[model samples]
Target: MMRSSPFLRGTALAVSLVLSAPAMAGGYAKSPPAQQSNEESRHRTLTNSPSYVPIAALTATVQANHRARGLLQIEAGLEVPDAQLRRRVERYMPRLRNAWVTALSVYAGVNYRYGDIPDADRIAEVLQEATDMTLGEEGAQILIGMIIIHGD
Candidate 1:
């Protein structure tokens, strides 16, 4: 039963670090951390495909009993079969999003209720019309992901 000297403990720690360094270096030398992350992210982005464009957080004011209660958040995506149309969709996303926000707001104001489920078919219809109207053609298809109503 004895205490190790400062020199002994320091030497032991240094030796352990020196022994572990090669293994750690080899592990990372295979692929740098940042590059690995970028590769993984690129793989995911590819798997999702350029055809599917995500539309996130389309919210509308939910008014109940003559007062604002909460908000109705709609999440959706567009599936365009044509790569050219997909590029156009991305280019016109700002205008398309504006049109959708207006349409969705109106739909939420008219159709949605405090304790009722949002009609998926009707919402999709609304979004499709908005898309077609904004894009001035028929190509991209609206795919609804979530219709969540946050209540107060």
Candidate 2:
């Protein structure tokens, strides 16, 4: 039988250990190199910049156990593509508010509790739908700046 030299055995073990170690660098990037500020992102939505129409804050009652549990407050803006569309929306403001309030009230009754605002995306989608229905097509969007639900 041949005996292996200690130096050779030690060299083999070292090589194996080095090869088995984890790599220190280089796979895939985990995220983007640059990130936008929230304000910048908000200002840069797809709608035209000068066409935001403000909606008054709306208060709707949410009930539980036949008692008023909370007030849901939503403040939003409509984004239209041009001054003409903006005027059309403004001319029909009463109808739009009525539709928005009704939509929000139904949403609050269905999906929210005393102190929770439903998902932002869900709210945005509902608002967009309401706008589309009111305007007879999909030409405008709703930009919801704040939504708050607080216990009574």
Candidate 3:
């Protein structure tokens, strides 16, 4: 009879244990998790710890009709630390929106092609720049709520 090495036996045991872990835990259930209420979801997302000021929804027309492809719509908000800065942001909303539109339009015209999804982070950065330039300050954080690209 040949004796198996202790190291080999230990390795095999470890592998078996790892493989059987899920079975030991009674396996997976068929049903998914219970859904939370819309109000609860919103409350979780919108925390009292930060001041969130709404930005007007913006629609950017990407490249001209390649069958209405590349049209982008963005809805966002700004999180400013204080009420005063929030007010300032509100006052400069028009300028900020214009800057964002110009930047996003140019970006889409150059970078967006057919069947391509726009990068939300990149667009958020662009919006942040516009906000900072308009406010003459840098603490505002851009929270993008929605980015819809109408592409075929």
How close is each model in CA RMSD to the real structure? 7.7, 14.5, 15.7
Deviation from truth (RMSD, Å), model 1: 7.7
Candidate 2 per-residue lDDT over residues 74-136, each given as its tens digit = 877887877788889999999988888898888788866655546878878877888889988
Q: Model 3, 6-70: lDDT tens per residue?
A: 99999999999999988876645433344335433553343354588765667777765554565
lDDT of each: 0.85, 0.77, 0.76
Score residue 5 of candidate 1 by CA lDDT. 100
lDDT of 2 at 122: 86
lDDT of 1: 0.85
Q: Count the backbone clashes (under 3 Å) in each candidate.
A: 0, 0, 0
- From the highest TM-score down, the ranking of the candidates is 1, 2, 3
Best by TM-score: 1
What would the per-residue lDDT of candidate 1 be over residues 110-151, giving only the tens digit for each residue?
888767888889989999999999999999999887788888
- Cα distance off (Å), candidate 1, residue 43: 14
Alpha carbon deviation, residue 88, candidate 2 (Å) = 0.5
**Best first by lDDT, ranked:** 1, 2, 3
Name the runs in model 2 displaced over 4 angstroms: 1-48, 115-117
Instruction: Tell me which of candidates 2 and 3 scores higher on TM-score.
Output: 2
Off by over 4 Å in 3: 1-50, 64-68
